[model samples]
Every structure is written in C-alpha cells, then in structure tokens.
Target: MNDSAAPVAGKTGLEFALLAEDGPARRGLITTAHGPVKTPAFMTVGTAGTVKGMTTEQVQASGAEIILGNTYHLMLRPGAERVARLGGLHRFMNWPGPILTDSGGYQVMSLQELRKITEEGVTFRSHLDGERHNLTPERAMEIQALLDSNITMVLDECTPFPATETEARESMERSMRWAARCRAAFTQRPGYGLFGIVQGGVYPALRRTSAEALIEIGFDGYAVGGLAVGEGQEAMFDVLDATIPHLPRAQPRYLMGIGKPADIVGAVQRGIDMFDCVLPTRSGRTGQAFTRRGSINLRNARHQEDQRPLDPDCPCPSCSDYSRAYLHHLFKAKEMLGPILLTRHNLHYYQELMAGLRQAIEDQRLDDFVAGFARQEAEGDIAAL
Candidate 1:
C-alpha cells in the first residue's frame, strides 16, 4: 500500500475483496494505499480537511478507518497546490487514514448564484471572496491529485430536484462525458483509485444509462450520486434498486452523502459498500446525539436533570465519562465542550453502527439485526440509564 508519489502497476491503487453477503448486504475489504477499510463502512466527513469540533486522534479513536476531503473547499481556501507543498491532505490535516475527496461538483452546483454550468465545465465565483474560478473535469482531477486523495470522485453535475426527464437525461449525459474526461485526466497510482458517480436524477432509465456508461469507462469503484440531494428515502431506495445491479459486483459500490441511519441500512440492504455524510458531526454541534436506540437532543429541558450517559450501551469516551446532565448544562451554557463531546459520541455511534452492520452481514443475520435495530429505534432514546 504505497499512497505516496511512486506508483505500482497492476495495482488498481485500491483493491476490494467481497468476503460475504447477507441478502443484498455485503461484508468486504477495501485495501487502499493507506490501509484496509471494511465494507458497509461509514467515512466521517472531514470536509475542509477536519471534522468539526474533534481532533484527528479523537476521530480515529471513535473507530473511523477513513475520512473524506472536499476538493472545492481546499482549492478555494488553502489552495490545492499549497496542500501538495505541505505533503498532501493527510499530512496537512494530520489524518493518517485513507481519505476520499469529492470531485467538487456538488459544491460548485450548490453555489447557484455564483456558478455557470456549461458542456465543458463550470465557471463560479468563490463565496470566500467572490473570486472567479473555472472548474472543468480536468481541473477537478488535478485538484484532487494535488490533494493526494486516496479515492478521487469524478466530477458530475448534481441534477436539480424535480427535473424533467429530458433535463435529467441531458444532465446525466453531460456528467458521463465529464466522468470520462476525469478518468483520462486522473493520474493513477498504486493505493489510489478514481470512482465514477452514477447520476440520473431519480430516473431509472437514466440511471441505467449512466451506470452502463460508467461501467464502459471503467472506474475503481462506482458511486451512486445525485439521489440523496432531496429525494425521500423511498425514492432514493428505488433508484438504488434500479442502479446497483448494473454496477460491477467485483468492485466496490459507494453511495455518496446518504443519509440518516435508516437510509444507510436500506442502502446497505441494496448492496452499497461504502458511505460518507456529515450528519452525525453536524448534528452534534446542534445538540443532537445519535444513540443505538434513537437520537437525543441535549438542548431539551427533559435532559437537564438526567444523570444517565447518552447511551448506556455505548462505550465512547463521551458516553463513558459524561452524564446527560453535564452535557445538557454545557449546551445550555453555550460551552465549547458541548459540541466536542457530542460530536465524539455521534461519530462513535456511527462507527459502532457500521461495525454492527458488517458483523450482521458476516454472520448472515443482517435481517435479524436490522429488525432489532428498527425496533430499538422505534423505542426511542431512553431518558434513564
């Protein structure tokens, strides 16, 4: 696993070995240049090179084997070239684990007021200082390469919600073309690989076309993108049902920016092997904590006098050392420790969830596990230890 500049041929830079399956759930191994990440793994998002409110060590201790980097944010703020000079994202951010960098498409597209889309690329103004910038597929590849991302996602225009079939088709076709360009532009190395995103804006036929197109282009992994943007979970699942079968069974399948716990379970049931999202960390700062039973809000008055840990079954530092009373007081006082502890707890919970999912798949008890999970969730977050 050499993630450094020197390349090794015949090594797709990433190797995936599917070891077991329970229904559509997969228990697999992903060998990256950095290290091995388990399938049905959840990548804690360090969007701007850091997960908010938590140190890298804390993040790792929470059981995250991999983290995600954002190309757009890095390019605009610290600049990708500067990161390269600083020895790439992992070194710059001081995160030693595998890092997956998005293609910068979603960020650019989200800048609706500042960006202009074209067949070739997108021209956008930086929200930081209103600086003009051009983001083509080639530039996207270069930026990610400079960041030294272990997994590079190809640039794809995130089709808007409620798009017409014709509109979605055009957007998907454009993304497919960009995916090809990104593939050509990306400099392959051992332990690093490019992933092509499947985009069809909730249209099954369009998804099929997009999936087939990416298959033809051939990527280290295939990612289902453009669905979790605004679609409800049911619609999202439908798209996955339509798309996953077309992707290569031998390779890894990534479902980008998805979702709540239920959404993840569903995607895993549909054969998604990898996932990344900011929900856990982001929700933490807002006083919400994810527990095996359900979610809890420290800001709620009911927690003010509670003496229990966030989750009795949890073994995270936050759950082990802190009480709901203390956490509630911290949030009420607007103390920094509030977000930090909650973020740590949330990340740990997410990792624990993934571990459970992997184990369930390996034991071929995924159905039982998922059923129990749903029941516990419906039982809601317990107020007492």
Candidate 2:
C-alpha cells in the first residue's frame, strides 16, 4: 500500500480498460497478475478456497474469469502463512485465473458478541476454537499479500444499518483512516492491486465523504461497501446514486456482497462494474435454481413429475442431461447429487447473465436487454406442470 503521495515509480498495478458503454452500463477488461477479467463480471463465490461442491475446472467451465476468496475463512482455517508456503491461493486452490480477497472486516463485524472493535483494529475469538486473533488494516494487507491475491480490499468497518448521521460519520471517518493505513501497508506489485472501500451506511452525505476520502488516498479500484446489509434495494441504489458520481470513472467499481440477478442489473445500470455474493450457490444447495424466468425451487411438488429441463435455455449438465422430475427426486430423496448438480447449474446461469449484460452494454442495447429480462421475470417460471 505505499502511503506516499504517488505510487512507487514504475510499479504499475492492475490495469482496466473500458471497451464500451451504454449509458451508465460499461463493458471493460481488468488485467490482473493471474489473467484478464471481463467486466461487468460476476465472480463466483469461492469462499474457503472452493466454490463449495464444484471443482476449479467446473467453476472455470461455468465461464467465470474471476473468483472471490474470503480472507476471514481462509485465515482461520488453512492459515494465510501456510497458504503462502504452499505457493499461494491460486496454486492451493488450483484456480489459475484472478482471485480477489476480502479484507475480513465484514466477517468480523458479523461476529457481534465475539468481537470488539477499537480504533487500532478488531479483536475476536475464532469461532473454530475460541482462540484470540487481531486484525488491523496493516495485518489485513499482509494476509492478502501472503495469499498472493490479485485484488486485495482495504479493511474497513462495515457500518451497520440504521445508524444515526453522527454514528455513520464516525464510522466512515474511522474507515477512511484505516483505508489510508491499508494503502500505506500494501505492497505494490505490477499486476496485483488494492481496492478502497466506501462505508457510510445509508446516509448520502457521509457516503460522499467516505468516497471523497478514499479517492484522495487513491486505490487500484473503488468498492461500495456496507450496502445490502438490511438496507432495502431502493435505499441501496439511492446510496449508489449518491456515491458513484464521485468515484474515478477510469478505474473499476465493485459492489460488495450484492445479490440477486435483478440486483446486479440494477447496480450495473447505476454504473457498478463488479459483484460477488453467496445467493446463487446457497440457493442451489437449498433446491433453488436461477432461470431467465426468475428462480424456481426444485423441491416443490410441481417439479416432481415435470420432465422438462430446469431451464431449457441453460446448457448446464443439470439441464442438458437431467429432467426437472429427476432433480426433484434427488432433493426429495436427500441425495448429495441434488445439491451438486444444482450448484453447477446456478453458477452457469449466473455466468450467462453476466455475459448477457456485457454483450448488451457492448451493443448499446442495455435498456432493451433489461426490458426483456424484466418481462421474463414478471412472467415467472414456466406454467406449472
């Protein structure tokens, strides 16, 4: 993180090039140390070094160019130092493409009763074995560096929702200070980079202030944090409306921990370029599948006798080789294969959605694409069996 006014001379970090734009929506490419990621990209959640049931090759086959790894989970289990010893996360996980690591702030925030936050950093007892650990902005940077992350996020307090203006401002300012420390502590690499996160809960003024402060410090990219944490969609978009204009347009903008398919579209419409979430995979494990006609539950009775593909449009093996009836049977029988198949299908569907959005942005038909998408969603899943 060079704390200096300018980046270390001759050390060019991550590179982003905007190839097309359709109003606020953008089509771009992010070249990282590992590889290139096409934007408006949807990074499959590979928390704990794996995307759950799917192999790295299966994840890659789902059309994902980038995947997200959680610092909190990895640090607690396999350990960051151990990961570094094993040739970093990419080699450890066998995922050759780019990997972005969260600084573990959000996970720490969620450990409400188990953690304490101070100006210096957060201290928490590990859920695994009740052992104590400290995570400061500098330590977060070091962990990500040890993991050899292509994109590392600055550690910022995840401002809780429903905070008063004063509370939000206090949290935002502290996060800004931590952002500066992270910037200074980060090790500059040619293709690896650090992203600064903007925190302010839902207060527009504080959001602007946080954004401005991070910009002053500078980063390889900007991320909108503290949204989707109980703030409804409209409020989240409102925050984006207030915050995005102040961000540097030439660099990538990421919306952290965001959401359903429609949520991604709406954020992209508001100019967000990257997203990661557990929804699709989590939903899949619970018998839900995403489709152009919205999401459907394979556990339902209607699917038990329906012989059609889960989504005829999807080329995933779950759809190409199995019928809705078979999928329903797997779930009903408590078979492990049920979740595995559905997870693959869900990731494939998400990748397809991102590809569609990218193509729409490139063709300057984003509005039209959105229109059709809304129409299909409104129509709902195919008529009951």
Candidate 3:
C-alpha cells in the first residue's frame, strides 16, 4: 500500500475502470488529477472548508481519497470571490486533493426561508445574513469552476418528501431543465467533470424520466438525489431500482447523502459507486461510534468502568490505544478530545467497510458478504462504549 501522505498530483481525466461486476455491485477505480479513488468510495463531507476536527493529514490517514466541499457554506463564510482570488478552494483550505463541490441548490432550498423558484433559478435569502441571493444553473456552474472544483454538481431543486405525484413530476422536469443549463455552462477540463443529480421524490415513472433526460444532456456521472431526505429505505430503494437502469453503466453513479451501513449496502447492490454523508462524523461528535458489529453510544453510563477498547476488531488509533473507561470519562467530563477521538474511529470504520465492500465485489461474493454483514448487524449494537 502506498502510505505516503502528500497530495499526489499529475494529469487529469477520470478513467473509470470496471475491475469486476457482482450483480449490480461493481469494483472499480476512478482516476482523477490528484490521484486514483477506489470505488465504491465514501467522500467525507468537509463543509465550511474543513472536515470538522480532522486535519488534512488525519483525514488522509483515515483512508479518504477525496473530500466534499460545500459551495453554499464557502460562498457565505469566506465568500467564493475571496476564495477564487486566494487561488481557489484547495489553496484556501490547504487540502490539495480533489474536492467535489455541491451547486448550493440544496442549501438554498433547505437552509433559506421563503425560497421562491422560477424558470431562471431560485431566489432566496442567505441563512447567514438574510442577504438576498439568486442561484441560477449557469451561476452555480460558474461558481464551482471558480472554486476549481475537480467535480461539480448540477443545480437541482431537492424536492421535499411527502410531495404529491404532481409536485414530484413538476420538480423533476424543472431539475432537468436546470441540468441542461448547467451542462451548457460547464467548461471542459481534462480531469475535471460535471455531474447531474436525478430528483423524482418517490415516484418511479418520474425517476425514469429524470434519468433519461439527464443522460440526454450527458455528464461524467449521475447522482440519485432527493432520496434519504426523510423517505424510508424501502421507498428510496424503489426509486433506485427504477432509476439506475436508465443511467449509463460506463459512468459513475453517486447516491447523495445516503445513509447507514445497511443503506449503503442496499444501494451498492443496486449499483452506486460514490457516497457522501455527515452521519459518521456528526454521530462521533455526539459520543456515538460505528463498529463492525454495530453502532455503540460511548456516552452510556454502563461504560464508566469498562476496560475494553471501543472495538477490538478496529485498528484505528482510538481502538489501539484508548480504553472504553477513559473514553467514557472524557465524554462525561465534556472534553473535546472525546468527540475528536470518536470521529477518527467512526471515519476509520466507514473506510474499512468500504474496503470490505470493494473486496467482496472484486471476489464476486457481494451477496455472501452482504449476508454476513446483515448477520453481524443482527448481533445487536455494540456493548455500551
């Protein structure tokens, strides 16, 4: 294994190589300008230009090949123009690896109040200052480019859950139109690429139409959005089944903000190459840790006298050196190190899970691997801490 920490730099261009295919699950490699990212990879979200407590070196050590940057957060805080002038996001944040930027569409809809949508784009007030802002498809594309994002997402209105079929169809159609405008605005970069997000709210036919329209416009990748936004797993899986087949197999498929271990496994079984979520990091900060067996809450009183590591099977720094009793004390004392250590452990666990999934796919044993994982999960949550 190449363990060197510095950002690997070279030629750009995504060369997605399918090494193996087990049912819909696949083992592949995504070569980017900075380095090669093994799929199915889970990108740690570094919203606000940082991955919470993790240093870039620590993040790399946790096995993340790429990190996600949020356009909305960066644009609001330090301002995108300032970032551009300071030599873009990579230099601004001191992370030289590849960064994928969201188009700020989701933030505009979710974070801002009284949002008004129109054919041109969305008009909403900034959650930070109540300052008015307009985010059109073209402007979103331009903003990502200005940030020098290796991968940029198209601006799509993330439809809220419990939406009626009529509302879902209308939202899907509008997203498709924005996708077209996003495509037209994107400038060609050898290694950089644009991705179109498919939104259909829980309707199968609408998902198919959205997928087909996005494929027509064409992009380096397709992301399934609007799922996981409060829709249960069964409902989300139904939409995936309806949409994945319509997408081109050669390109990568990303499932945005997708979920727990079970959720990731199900999506991989249905064909997804990339994923991103705040669950692991955020949960860690709250004294929760993920393990091979299941999730464990470190804040539970039962761990006050426990001598065991968080997970004996885990090879992370926290598991290697810290005892559950020590961790419990830290949390009980409200120490910042408690969350930091747990975050590292959670990130390590997620990376290990992804490695296991990739190996299983390559060995054509995904079904068996998934079955074994389910069995482990059934073993119940880890003993407190």
Query: Across residues 1-385, which tens digit of lDDT does each residue of candidate 1 receive?
Result: 1223222123366888777888878888888888888878999999898899989999999999999999999999899999999999999989988999998899999999999999989999999999999999999999998999999999999998989999999999999999999989988888899999999988899999999999998899999998777789899999999999999887899999985899998899899999999999999999999887788888999888888899889999899899999999999999999999999999999899998999898889999989998998788745442
Model 3 / residue 8 / CA error / Å = 23
Residues 52-126, candidate 3: write the lDDT tens digits: 988888899899988999988887788888889999988888887889999988888886455789999998887
Report lDDT (Cα) of residue 77, candidate 1: 83
lDDT of 2: 0.91
Cα lDDT tens digits, model 2, 1-385, are 1112222232239888778889988788888889888889999999999999999999999999999999999999899999999999999999999999999999999999999999999999999999999999999999999999999999999989889889889988999999999999998998999999999888888888899998889899999999888889899999999999999888899999996898899999989999999998999899998987778889999888888998888998889999999999999999999999999999999999999999998788999999999898788856842
CA RMSD per model (angstroms):
3.3, 4.2, 3.5
List the lowest-lDDT window of 10 residues for candidate 3: 1-10
Compared with the true structure, all predictions reach lDDT values of: 0.90, 0.91, 0.87
The total number of steric clashes, by the backbone 3 Å criterion, in model 2 comes to: 3
Candidate 1 regions exceeding 4 Å error are 1-11, 381-385
What order do you get sorting by TM-score, best first?
2, 1, 3
TM-score: model 1 vs. ground truth: 0.96
| Candidate 2 lDDT for residue 188 | 90
